[model samples]
Target: MPRRSRTLTGLLLFTSLTLTTAGIAGIAATANASPEAPAAAAGAHTAHKAAYSMPGMPGMPASTRASGDDPDGDGYIMADPPVTGVTPSMEVPPPAYFHEFQAKCAPTHTAPDDPIVYPGQPGKSHDHTFMGNTTTNANTTTASLETGDTTCLAPGDKSGYWMPSLFDGDTKILPEGVQTIYYKSGVTDYRSVRPFPKGLRYVVGSPMQTQEEFKNLKGTVEGWECGDSFKNYNFPATCPDRQDVQLNLRLQAPSCWDGIHLDTPDHKSHMAYPVAGGANYNSCPADHPVALPMIEFKMAWPVNGDMSNVRLASGTGYSFHYDFMNGWDAATLDAMATHCIKGGLQCDPHGYDENHPGQGAVLDENYELP
Candidate 1:
């Protein structure tokens, strides 16, 4: 993902956080799904999101953030702005926390279904490798997601995350090790980063896209990884034969969202990437003004060495796409944004920043529900 642009001087505030349980009681939850494909692991916040607004949006009933900035006049403000030159590294940089938090997960199952696109109809889509919400399928619903078993470290992360299944020759392969999914502040200001609404669903990338089109996507970080080197948009012809290191795919979701609709016919109309200002992204487009956590997926594939035949079920390596359905424990997710993001710190899968080990926002004892 492109770094926040300094071109749009001053600071921009993200508003519009009015999460309510209005749909089917069972399928009702936070409708927060970004266009980026984050390998989500943090327990998803439950469905009871308070009817409150973030910094730049109206109706800010209460705010834990101290009063400091009001770029768009939403009562909320930014006390301490983001550090100017701190570039995010693919790997977490020790104890220093950035404006980010993460969840780690492993594959739970595979199916030829997509609840968001072809709901209630299994086998309507291509085979997909799923993580989190173990029971995710074509019939998956918000209620089902909340109750399904999870592979993520955070118990609250009931959300379902998946990508087209990958294959080596004719045999299917799965990702090995823990997959880290990052939810970060997409806006330059982190104080107002709000949690996504429940049941929110969105698609990132498309199997039908051409290689050039995939390359033009703002959030595309297309590539494979083998130890120290990682620069191939398509799988490298080969990789070092090793166990410690596996092939990886890191993807990002668009951070900006439209406050109104949770989803649209296209599944992507409600979300958008930050617009370019100079060389970096400076602000969200007017249509998608709400700046939510930028979802980043660092998927770890099991294949190594022989990369002569590795491809996604969707098509060529460039035909990458993924899906997300918000099903987090509402309270937990909200706190994560409060302490880790608004507090401006990089956090672990449980939203804990060891460097500032004070009792701030963090995962509860079991990292899950009772």
Candidate 2:
């Protein structure tokens, strides 16, 4: 199996716009916003939803073999194996859904662990800051943006960005004497707007295009969203082309938050998995089990040759990064939290009960590059 690569930490500062009608100009105007605009002041606005995306990994079929020397040695041993004779599990999930979200200056959401390293440059390092505090303008414009220029942009923390673990706590834990973890495969297709969504940013100093390759091949495809019924919601008598090829190979566990417990109304609760169940090989360790979790996705539009920086166009170059955080449900979270407590790592849950910390464990820690 080929190893995944890490992403660049920082880029040279650049000026960009916020999304507002009149108070602030659109991203287009920001591309031309005069410095005389009195340097827009920061407002009291916080990130509402997590911005993240999975990046490309070696295709699942190819990734199945752990190494060459031991080519056939338990090569198919996975907690959840891939579906037989279907689209490769590594391809993007089918019917990828797109959501409109706010775009913010990158610096405001930096992770503490993010080290400042200028993009495409080496040896020189510096802190990054955002162009503004909130998207006060309604027209949605970004102005006078230039990469590698210090006068335009800013910095933010990049710590605790990716999902700590699929289990929600420290260490990879599996049941004793388990025969195999079961998983099903399905796909989801996703599309974007003309200029792509704005106000989208990542605290990890990472780019969004990196995750596209991953998103395209590993999107989750199950439950109501994937032609299944949770309510009286009548789905297609037969799956449509819109619902072609994309699929998620997940553990055949019951419905619960974050892919446990088979009962639930939401499909987004399902996270994309690389190695799922029901195979006759060994892709992962038998005694020690582990899986990746869903995280925030960050993406960026591409700037053309003559167009001003802020008016840049969106393309496959539009990178995406997933920030796997603590959003799993109580049961799975508590189990991992228990594991972490035993290991001496202090954790505190972000959105649940006071006693239960939504701590995540680390599994395959690396950037998802296409």
Q: Model 2, poorest ten-residue lDDT window?
A: 13-22
Per-residue lDDT tens digits for candidate 2, residues 1-370, read 2211112100100000000000112222112223421122111000111111212211111111222212232211111222123222222322312211111222221111111111112211111112223321111111211112211011111111221111101111111110111111111111100110111111221232233332333331221122232221112123223423211112121111111211001112122233333442111111111222122222211111222111101111122112211212224333322333222332221112223344343211221111
lDDT of 2 at 211: 34
lDDT of each: 0.63, 0.19
Q: Put down candidate 1 lDDT per residue, 1-370, tens digits, no spaces.
A: 2222323211222221211100112221112223322222111101001212224432222222211112232222121222133222222223323789888877777666777655655665666788888889977777788888788888878899999878776566777645789998766556656788766777776665566656666667755567776757677788888878778878788877666445543456556776543343255656566677889888877677878877776657776778898888888788777878878887887677877778453776676532
lDDT of 1: 0.63
Best by TM-score: 1
Q: What's the CA error at residue 232 for candidate 1, in Å?
A: 1.4
TM-scores of all candidate predictions against the true structure: 0.71, 0.23
lDDT of 1 at 53: 26
lDDT (Cα) of model 2: 0.19
